[model samples]
Target: MTDLNALEDWAGPLLRKIEPAGRAKLARTLAQQLRKGQQERIKAQRNADGTLYTARRPHKLRDKKGRVKAKAKMFQKLRTASYLKAQGDAKGLAVGFTGRIARIARVHQYGLRDRIAARGPSAQYEARELLGFTVEDQEALKDLVLAHLDL
Candidate 1:
């Protein structure tokens, strides 16, 4: 028979007691890092001038003779460019908005993320069992985490 409780051994007594605090601290650190990181990203990321996306502008119909009925322009922003670089921006090959990768990004205003915790402890927890650690879900957690920890 498999001892389901055996996992507790690995977690140790802290699992029941310290885990919450550790996790809260972790969450707190995560929020602070993410927020600062996002700010840095925004600061570093060049103000996008244009991109391959939807655009809106005033326009006018043209005549066969080449008479302009109206004038207009397009609007767009390439989100890809703003993407955090591999090492310089993110810690490593950043993943899409998910797990720890996302939790890290949650602090960002635009939710832009780096790729640091791709395959580490934070990554493992965020992906494996950080149930409420998604971008959308981390909102309340962010507040709580911030409150719990110094950061």
Candidate 2:
């Protein structure tokens, strides 16, 4: 058999015990850093491909009166296969990453405000992946390294 230890190497030392506190700590750290970079990139830019990436959309709600709801902000939904059926039925928008995805892309709206709310960017991002050195930036490798860490 081809060596799968490389997979283990690609994974951190915590690969064998994803549920343990040590792995959880590393995952949280990595997730935080990853998310931060994405936010900054979106923030520094004005329009996301001229259509307003989810993080740049204007809030779309109004209060009891007609003042544009104070807290009504843009929304995004990142979905996976599990979320597909439910969000689709609700008329939510789904965006695909064109690569390996932990979950399907079912998020179809909103941006920063939604992201800041702790709900995270609403669009289902291709599952955060850690890939081989050779295909690092290929953008379509099916190997998702973060899967073990999160769920």
Candidate 3:
């Protein structure tokens, strides 16, 4: 988690200078950019800290003819904009998983144990940070805010 006090101290003056309409627009743009960056990181199977996510357990399945199916990427559906939403208003912005998918995301996010299926056995999922603020993200936000302000 980021230091709220530090962020407030740093951004408060800049944010106060913008009118309400401009603040809302800035928030919306920031949310979209944050969402885009998150999707890219997820696609690369990387955490916000620049570490690779733990590999999924090998689960080989064979066709009737005995050919092994290729492994699919993780969080394919979860990474989409529909499931991973970006919401922003004059007050603030947020990028996160929405609805029932949030439950599934929580399991993997904290290395929690959960059932594999409706009646399947439980298994431990590794902790993979699905969302976080990174150093690059901070720089991008700073640049974006400066550009928005025409500074």
Give the whole-model CA lDDT for all candidates, comma-separated: 0.34, 0.32, 0.87
- Per-residue CA lDDT of model 3 for 9-124, tens digit only, reads 87779998999989999999989998988999999999988899999887757765868788899998899999999988889999999778999999988999999999999998
Cα-based TM-score, every candidate: 0.23, 0.27, 0.93
In model 2, the Cα lDDT at residue 8 comes to 41
Q: In candidate 2, what are the lDDT values of residues 13-62, reduced to their tens digit?
A: 54554555555554444443334333333333322222233343344565
Q: How badly does each model clash, as a count of residue pairs?
A: 5, 22, 0
Give the winner by lDDT: 1 or 3.
3
Q: Which parts of model 2 are misplaced by more than 4 Å?
A: 1-9, 12-14, 17-19, 46-151
CA RMSD of all predictions: 17.7, 14.1, 1.6
Clashing pairs in 1: 55-75, 58-72, 60-70, 92-115, 94-115
